[model samples]
Each structure stands twice: as C-alpha cells, then as structure tokens.
Target chain A: MLGIDDPWIWGVYLLCIFSTLLCLVYGLVNWNKEGEQEALEEKEEEAWEESEEEMQQKELGM
Target chain B: MNLLLLNIIILIYLLATLYLGYRGWKSTKDSEGYLVAGRKTHPYIMAMSYGATFISTSAIVGFGGNAGLFGMGLLWLTFLNIFVGIFIAFILYGKRTRKIGHNLNAMTFPELLGKRFDSRFIQYFSGIVIFLGMPLYASVVLIGAARFMETTLAIDFDVALLVYSVIIAAYVIWGGLRGVMYTDAMQGTIMFVGMVFLLFMTYSHLSGIVPAHQALTDMANLVPAKLAALGHAGWTAMPVLGSTWWWTLVSTIVLGVGIGVLAMPQLVVRFMTVKSNRELNRGVLIGGIFILMMTGVAFTVGALSNVYFMQKLGNISINVAAGNADSIIPIYINAATPEWFVYLFMLTLLAAAMSTSSSQFHTQGSAIGRDIYETLTHKKGGKSILVTRMGIIAAMIIAVTLGYILPENIIARGTAIFFGLCAAAFLPMYTSALYWKRATKAGAIAGLITGTAVTVFWYLFIHKAEAVPLGICKMLFGRDVLIASMPWPVVDPILVALPMAILATVIVSLMTKGPRDKHLAECFRGVK
Candidate 1:
C-alpha cells in the first residue's frame, strides 16, 4: 500500500487540526465578553441620556 | 412511492419559508430594518446566519465534488474556512466593521466603504462591481442546488433550476435581510445535522477512517493520466510542489476563497447585523462549529466516497459514474443512504442553496438600489426600497440565465473565479480602509481599479483556463497567452493581481495628502 512515510507531512496535518481546535477553544473561552447585550444597552442608554440633557438645555435657553 | 413524501416535505419547507418571510416583512418598518436587520440581531441568529451564507452548496456540492477527485488535500480549505472565514473574519474584521458601520449609519458594505472614505465614487464603484461579479457566484449556487435536485428527484434540469430560483427569489425580494437570516439559521441547523450524518455514515461504510484512507492511497495508480500529468501524486498526498495541480489547489482554491471571504459584501454586511461586539464575539464559536461540521465533514465524506465507490462498483471512478464531478455527491448519497435519509439530505441541500442565494440577491440588490442608484440620485425613504426590490428581480434573472448556460464541472471553478476576483478586486482596499489611517480616497480608487483591471486582463488573456474558452488571446495573438515565455502557464489571477493592488494602494496613499481631519475624526470616533 502506498502510505505517507514522511513524519513532517503528518505534523502539518496535525498542526492544521490543532490550530482549528485552538480556535474553537478560543471561541468557547470567550463566549460571553463585555461586548454583548449589557454593554450595548449601556451605550444606548448613555446616548439617550445625553440627547435628553441636550433637549432640556435647549428648552431652558428658550 | 417516496416521491409523494418528498413533495410533502418540500411543501412544508416552502410554507415555513413563507411564514418567516411574512415575519421579516412585518419587522421591516424602515430601510435599516430591511437592509441590516436594524443592527440588533441576536448572537445565535447572526452566527448561524453568517455560517449558512458563508458555507453553501458551493462548499458542499461543488468543493465536495472537487475533494472526491483531488483527494484529502482539499482539507486545507476546511482549515482556512474556519481560521480565516470564521475566526479572523469575526475578531479582526467583524469588530471594526460593526463599529464603523454603526458610527456611519452604513447599510451595506459598499456604503460602509463609501462613508469611511467620504467619497461617492468608492461607494458606487464597489457597488457596481458587486452588481456585476456576484451574479456569477449566485449562478453557481443555483446550478449546484439544481444539479442535486435533478439527480435526487429525477426532475428535468431546467425545471429544477427554475423552481429553485423562483422560490429563493420570492423570499429575498419580499422579506429582505431579516427573512434571509431567519431562513438561514434554520437552514444552517439542517446542514450541520445532515453533514454530521454523512460523515458518520461514510466512515462506517468504509469500515473506519484509517482503512478508508489506506484504501484510497493504495489505489494511487488509479489517478487519471490527465490528472497525473498535471502533477497529481496521489489523492491523499499534496500534489507535487509548483505543479499545475498544486497551483490550482493552493493559489486558486485555497488562498482564493480563504482570503476572498474577508471582502465578500454579503458576508461583511453580516457583521453589522449584530448589536454589540459581544454578540458578534458570541457568534464566533457557533460559526466555528457550524463551519467545521459543514466543510470538515464535506471534505472527509467526499474523499471517503472514493473508497465506497471502489468497493462496490469495481473500477468505475466517481466522475464516470456521476457523469460529472458536480453530480458525484448526490449520486453517492443516493446509492449509500436509505430512502428516508435521502429525503432529509435533499432538504439540507436545498437549505444550503437557498440561504447563500438569498444573501447574494440581497447584497446585489442593495448594491444597485441603495449604493448605486439611491446614492447617486440622493434618493431615500420608500423610493430606495422600491429600487432595491427591482434590483433583486434583475439579479435573479441574470443569475438564472447564467445558471442555464454554464458547463458541468463549473461549480467549483465558478466559485473560485468569483472568490478570486473578490480577493483581487476588493481585499486590499477593504483591509486598508479598516486599519490604515493614511489610506486616501485616491489610493482606494486606484487600488480598486488596478486590481480589477489586472485580474480581468490576466483571466482573459494570460490564464489558459479562461483564454482557451474565451478564444480572445487565440484570436488576437494565435496563442492562449500573450507572454508565451512565462514559466508558469496557468498562475491564478490572485497571485499577481493582489500584490499589484496592495502596492498601488500603499504608493498612492504615500503620495497623496492626508484625508480631511473632520472625516477622519468622525469615521474613527470611539475606534481605538
């Protein structure tokens, strides 16, 4: 049977698999970061509060 | 007997898709909702949708068929899909794309670029390229799905093509991005489950992974003479280095699609669909798993199919039995699986086709309607939506026409060509726009033009693959390529075009003055 004799070739294949697994692990480890729902809601609220302040200041000037 | 059950299942799928379309229609109150799902999509939905759009029948049927012929070496593409298409795309590109897209209120990829550069030409030009290039890619998806149906259902090829096109077009035109993503999530689930079963069944059929690969390797003498001439060493091993097969596999297929994923307008627009970077981040693992199952399984099963065919049919190769490489997967599934599983796999294939095509139609429609016509005319509100719908219809027609005309064994080549074109034409300028503070409007335009021009010139003139069929070089110069002295006869366009584009961008930016301070401040706001 014609089989792969080179150890380095197998190493490359293993490396590819290992890298993919590493990526998967990286993704799983960082599943819920500070960048998801709570952070987005906080940013939106800040924007809303700033807009409301600006409107109130405009009314006071008038 | 089974046809009636298959029909019922398809009818159910159609009804579900229609219902989702109605929900999308209701959710779409304004242009933003229709275009980018209002940028509040959940991580699960966004992740699944991105995976579905990114890995379609082109990966399963087209590239799977390729793996069957070319062997396990195609697995490198699987690695690239996960590493580049999913992880890097989400972490590096998706984060910045989402932030800047939100900051500029950009609806499409072209709009994001245009708004970032503060130039209407960059926006309209990229839109026009998407409008032109995406149809060929869409047509390949359409052809892949139709080929599967024709083999599985025993329907006329023309009828299958028409039915596939009509169903996907209806949802895309009526429901927009929301409808597209909703269907995509469901479709992605079906594809994952179907592929998992396929991989398991393939391994079991071959008596296990080691023996299966050993059998394939033992049959190294079975390599077609034509393929061997092209430097194919064996199915399991990488082709001889720098051989035509090696170049085709590495440069054209692997690097082309791997790098091309970053610049796809349909996929890039997906990053903007999520709410926060966390939602986008959450999508990374889900997308990773989904792509792994879809592509990893496809390449494995595709290669193992040779073992199955060899054991059963004596001497008939996959290409001989299926008549064409594109039809090999369906032919093998029909022979290998039970009746019930075949029916379910059919839906999985349909999901694969519809999800990708719907996104293509939507991206092209937005390119034409929102990016080109509306931006140029300064139109907004309901009028833009009307234009987009019309553009979707136009895209569907063009894709269907091309689907009918394309040749067999074209699914993989067509996919590679489009991906390669996108990489050459858009990747450099796109990456620079996101990361480079010194990138000027002049530089972006010059890069865009040079990249597209060089790729087209090479494909039409220098590359024997297209030149032989196009006959342009043969007619003008009595040879396939003008420069007959070149060592490599068929170098992929990306190898040459990408570097030229990158060089032009860097050189032009250095020569030009900095972009307006006001524009830079607004564009890079909150982007540290």
Candidate 2:
C-alpha cells in the first residue's frame, strides 16, 4: 500500500544477484597477483578437499 | 487509562509472583536446587524454559514493531529461529552440551568453560565477561516491557520499569533458578495465549487490506521519495537489493541472528539443565512450536499494520513517532487496535520480557556469583546461597540502570551483541571440547580471548553509530580502518573472528600437550 511497485520486482532482484556473481567470476583476474595470496588459496583448497572426503566417508557410513 | 483495572492486574501479578517465590524458597535447601533445579525436570518445563529464555520482550516489542517499519521481510528471522536457533540447537548442540555438563557436575556457564579446558582460569574469566556483557542485554529487555506498559496503561516509563524490575528481582533473588524456570513456564503460557489473541485481532483490523491497497494504488507516484532513500521499491514487497536496507537485513539481521543463536550462553546453559541427550532431542518440537507462534504471529500482525494505518488514517503508511524502533509495536497496538486487546497485549509482552530477562539475570548472576566468585576469589563464603541471591539483586540493579538510561534500537541489535559475543567467546571452545581430543587449555584461552575481544571491537566501533553505541568506548582508543572509509562498517565479526578462533584453537591445541587434568578422560565417556 505504501507503493514501492509490483511484487515481481523481487524476482528481478534475484536474477540480478546471479548475474552479479557471474560478473565476479570474470572479474577475479583483476585481484592482486600476490604470491602469498595464491599460496594461501592452494593450502585452503587442499584442506577443503580433505575435509570434504572425510565428510563423504562419514555420510556413507550413516 | 483505566487506572483501577490496570493497577489490580499489576498488583495481582506481583502478589502471585511473590507467593510463588516463597513456595520455592521453602523447597530450595542446597546449592544444587538453587542453580540446576535438581536436574530432574521434565522436557516440557525445560523446553518452556528454553523457549521463554530465548524469546524475550525484545522479540515481541522490538522485532514486532520493526515489522511495521520493514514490512514482512523480518519474518525470515522467525523462520531462522525455529529451524536453526531452536530445532538444530537442541537436536545438535543441546544433546552434546547437556551430556558434557552433567558429566562435569557443572552449575554455571563459567563452570562448563573451566571444566572443558581443565583451567579454572578460563571458567573464572568467562564468568567475568558474561557478567560484564549481559547487563547491557538485560537492561534492554526491561526497557522493552516498560515501553509497552507506558503505552498501554499510560504509566510513566520509569515507574513501569521499576515495578517490573522489583517484581522479577524479588522472585529471582528468593527463588533462584528453579523459581525462575517455574515462573518462566507461567509467563511463557501468558505470552503464547496473549500473542495468539492479539494476532487474531490485528488480522481482523488488517483483513481489509485489499480495499486499503486499492485505495493506495490509486496514488502510486505520490509515494514519498524518502522511502526510496529508505531503500524500498515498495512497502508490500521486500527491500531493494544492494541498498543499505538489504545489507542490514541479510548480513546483520538474518545471518547474524541465524548463525549467532547457536552460541548463546544462556541458551547453551539451558542445554545443560536436562538429564540426557534424549531430553534435549524431545525439546526440539516444543521449542519449535513456541518460537513459531511467538515470532510467526508477531510478524504477520506487524505486516498487516500498514494496511490498517493506511485505511484508517488516510495515509499510505504509519511512521514510527519515537526514534527507538522498540516503540513501533506498542504504537501499532495502541493506535489501531481495540482497548481490550491492548491490555491483553501488555500482559503478553510482560510474560515475554520477564521470562527472557529472568533467565538472563540468573545466568549472568551465577556467572558472577558462583562461577567467578567461587573460582577466583575462593573467598570461602560459608553461605553461597546468600551470595547467589545477592548477586541476583546486583544483576537486577545493573540491568535496571541500563534499561532506564540507554535509548532503544531494534531488539535484535542487543541480541546480536550478546549472542555474537557468546559465539565468539565460547562456540569454538565448546565444539573442540566435545569432539577434538587435542584441545588444550592454552588453545581455549586464545580462542576465547581472540573471539570475544574482536567481536566487541567490531560491533561497537565498525557498525553504524545510528543505533545505540553498545560498548564502543574501548574501540575509541584502538584503530579501525573499515569505519574510516565506509559510513558504517559492514564487517560482521563472526565471519572474520569465529574462523580465527576455531583455527587458532585447533592449531594451538595440536601444538600443546593435551589436558593433564584427571577428569579429562572421564568427560569423553559421558555420552558413551
């Protein structure tokens, strides 16, 4: 009643969020090329994989 | 104001509370009864206590009123509460916390913290932090209930606060934790029934929304431009994305409360109250239902208030007169609803506020009296019950002072500060204690210190100055880079601080020798 607009505007916003995330993927190269940051990412990737595998095994048992 | 009826209701409520306290006083003979309610409570009572303790006057008055300002978008928080805060908390955290707590024979939060780390220092320090932090939270609950009374009965705000405070303090001081839980059950029932009735009334008033919206849609462009600046394309819908409204809604309100609730010290202690993990598993349904009604109904009614205000007042919407968002729910209740409904809503709010406040007061009081006082000073008091009762009085005074003095923000802001602090302070340590065999005392100390300090630093210094400055004095001397550039900092500390605490606890615990305490191995066998 306060007159913002159609309820479907919410739908447009949700779509924009997806597009924004896609843009961020394309924009990732613009981030600083620091070696330490790269190393940190690789280290985190390994940890993530290990944790993921452990979790999968736990799920299989359950 | 119908002074006589209001007076009689308040007086009778007060008298009943005192008599109940006296009855509890006769039964309480030892430290065990005072703190843990003899550990033989039914799931229903414990569930009510858990629900009551979590849903406060802040939720009813502060968040309810916010629905008037924000539309129904805030309903997400209620959903988060039942699903994440209540269901998962009991189903996952409660079962584990209660087992560990019962194994340790812990009575207070600090005791749990201390026992977990094999460090009396950690427990004692945790107690100090809880005592220091909780008054700010407790006082807001007092202010919320007082605001409702002031609006409904035409009572002075100060007078309402004092009356409510005295009644609660008297009962809590005399009766201790069991008395608090008994009254919480009574109060929870009052809140449940009252909110349900008010929701029905608000719906009837707002049911005419189709007509009202038709009337307002007639003048769509005439909508104020300021609201666009207020970050909405329209009131009937959610906030515009990337607006300040969206950020606060998503980052702070929804995510903060959703993730943050899992770590609340008062709630975590509720987990410790029952006999077994099964009791906790049972509490999930009970807590879920209570949260759904208390929160779901408030938001539904709040969203409907817009239609009511627009139709009756010939305005497109209602603007909150007071700067404090806590006043919004009271304003809607008073302005548009029938007078009889107002009285009932007041009682509902009193129940909501008192139940939460008493839990907070006792939790904080015990944190100071039994946790820190017994652990550090080891003053060897002959009568600990006397000290515990006095601690309750002191806690009441601190909360009373804060409630009367501090201005209101939305209730969620205070809730965030306390729960955020809890999550930062205790969550990582608790997780490790339950499952990670390597968790050391030093690692716990790091996690607690790093998490708590960083959370306090961020919420106070980085967040906007628009709301009340909840403990920013310390950050004034310290530096903040994020606040310098942005209007307000968007950094929610949990995203940053929590992981740091977890990582630090794990890394440091692995580096150090496991706990040397004799009780350490026995604790792991508790759940087994």
Question: Against the true structure, whose TM-score is highest?
Answer: 1
Predicted candidate 2 versus true structure: per-residue lDDT over B1-528, tens digit per residue: 576886688677767767766766777655666788766566778888888888888777777766666666676677677777776677567766776776666777678778877789888888888888888779888888888888777889999899888888878887877788888877788788888777667655544435433433344443467767857544445677767776676666767666778877777877766655556555665676677778777765665665666666655434544345566678777887677767777777888888888888888778877887778776423245567667788988988987777755736567666766777788898778776767899999999988888777666666654222444443454553345553356546666678888888888888888886566766754454
Computed on C-alphas against the true complex, the DockQ of each candidate is 0.23, 0.03
Give the lowest summed-lDDT range of ten residues in model 2 chain B: B465-474
DockQ of 1: 0.23
Clashing pairs in 1: A35-B278, A36-B278
Q: lDDT by residue for model 1 over B278-363, one digit each (tens)?
A: 78767887888788788778876777687788788865346555557787788889988888889989999999999999999999
Q: What is model 2's native contact fraction?
A: 0.05
* Weakest lDDT window of 10 consecutive positions for candidate 1 chain B: B314-323
What TM-score does the A-chain of candidate 1 achieve? 0.50
In model 1, what lDDT does residue B518 have? 90
Colliding residue pairs in candidate 2: A4-B233, A4-B234, B65-B329
